[model samples]
Target: MGRTRDRLKKAIAQSRIPSSHGIRYANELLALGAWFREHAEGVPAFARNRDLYAHVNEEVLGDAPIDLFEFGVREGSTISKWMEVNSNPASRFFGFDSFEGLPESWRGGVGETPAGSFATGGAVPRLDDERVHFVAGLFQETLSAFLTQDYRPTGNRRVLHCDADLYSSTLFVLATMHPWLDPGSVIVFDEFDSPLHEFRAFVDYTSSYRRRFRAIARTGPLLARLAVEILE
Candidate 1:
């Protein structure tokens, strides 16, 4: 009887029929492909760093002092890139990270990312410039305090660079930054297509707050830039 059952299970495994999860994943991919097809021209145009930099430069007011924040500053590469492209001398850059990778697993247990996957051993990189600053520790521990006390109003033109890859982390950061996000603020997501993480978080946040944000530019399906129109 045991041998017969094992053979039956093996046959099922070898069959062409896919599991429920497989079907769902296929459907989701199809939907994503359809979306890409609909937004074809813009996807390729803004996929490169130079193009994104050009768009940001045009979007921001040249005379205003820039207030830029990066959520996941891994080895300080992107921050450096931003500083390099920015011609405004008064622009201030803030990079936030635990330097110890993700605080928890993303998308429950199904997702492959493990906790502490991007850990940097708490070693913050030196940007050398006095205009740039690094905030160490998890977002939950440092974000609120930074907003309340340390973050002085420089200019209305602000840019938030989100690299943290998890629904919880993204949601928390959005909610915490809500009050400060006014008109002309740009939020860039580095991993926007992680459906269970960034995509879901953005949808839930916008719906809950009734905020009106437009996707001004995108660097392929992975990276997207949204311009805020919030009043308060």
Candidate 2:
């Protein structure tokens, strides 16, 4: 089996045919499907991402005060849902985004989402909630400073909402935030079905970081929105 896998990899690397690109994507989806079957087969499924968030907030985190960091806040919708579901005054919600959409073109099952697709004309949403905060810039430029100077670790559970639709963005956030990821940290991915992007990041991050997590809940077709609890 190992030899066969190696031969296939070699052939794929050597291939220059245009159709090979599609084959590679299909292979990634196959891998993702296998992973979902293993990790999320019996997990609760919801009709909407908000419902999944509520489940994670109420059932998984027990509606306790949480340090929620959202990586890709476009229009502030999902973060708003999170704040509404977990209405602990003590909970702090921080949103990080370029507010300029994706840094690069994203090619996934739904075709290419061009760079700047989600741009809000560089304006941050106006949320009336003081508990919510927004950091406007690319994650590469802003996150390290925020983590070092502004972020304060507390007794509150940490929830990472990774809506960044690019593999590079998702992996960077996961790796950079590794130090603060405790055993019980909850990571909710907003687009887990994009095998080459978010799902690839999840697989790579866990493998590279030596992290362990269990899928607790999912929503959307093909488990698009997935929430997992870190176990180690």
Candidate 3:
């Protein structure tokens, strides 16, 4: 009976939802979400966070290859989970980290954690996945190198996931990636809901722009800091 129930649960998770995502990548997202939840047990309690990243990515679907840059990837877990679920042959996932740990200081005041406290000692678990790319060193330095030398996009269909933990690095990415952005570009703030970091960065980005945007939420509390926003 327990086995039967498990099979039924798996069946439900594997089921694809109806979406305007077209055929290929649309169905892939549903499956990837299921796989991430199933096989990757004993993982950190970051599924919900990654799900938020994936959900917003789904809303900004395109037939062209998917290009993504993740500010912080502790180990390649989230991207691996994402690849398992979506399994996009064309999609490319990039993660940027100090690898050695957090930066020196976060400039403005942040939350409970100190500026350098979150450092992981630069030892992110390595994985050999074709879809994933790992960028080591400070984002401020590595990012510009990538745009000119390493990264070449098709339609430049990109998703920027900023988990840099501080405003300086976060704002730096926004400035550099701004020119590459098209109407389809999607930016994910891992801590966008935070009172100090992301919100402050968003204010700076919006301060100069005259155009307004529509917001979409897939889960959690609708308040700004409590949830992630989809600006369209």
TM, every model: 0.78, 0.91, 0.67
Scored by CA lDDT, what does every candidate get? 0.70, 0.88, 0.57
Each candidate's number of clashing pairs is 0, 0, 3
- In the order shown, what is each candidate's alpha-carbon RMSD? 8.2, 5.2, 15.0
Better of 1 and 2 by lDDT: 2
Pick by lDDT: 2 or 3, better one: 2
Best by lDDT: 2
How should the candidates be ordered by TM-score, best one leading?
2, 1, 3
lDDT of 1 by residue, 1-232 (tens): 2332343455345545445533443444344345444533243246576567557666644545678889999799888888877757889999999999888875321236778888888899987889899999889999999999999986547888888988898999988998888877777777765555675677678779888765556665333443333333
Candidate 2's TM-score: 0.91
lDDT tens readout by residue for model 3, 1-232: 2332343355345545332322323233234334333422222222365565455555545334678777777666656665654556888888888876567554221114545655677776577777788888888889899989998776546766677766677778777877676555666566553334564565466455422333333223322211223344
Please provide, for model 2 over 37-87, each residue's C-alpha lDDT reduced to its tens digit, 9 standing for 90 to 100: 799978999998888999899898999999999999999999999999999
Candidate 3, clashing residue pairs? 32-85, 99-122, 100-122
* Candidate 2 lDDT (Cα, 0 to 1): 0.88
**Which prediction has the highest TM-score against the true structure?**
2
Q: How many Å off is the CA of 184 in candidate 3?
A: 1.0
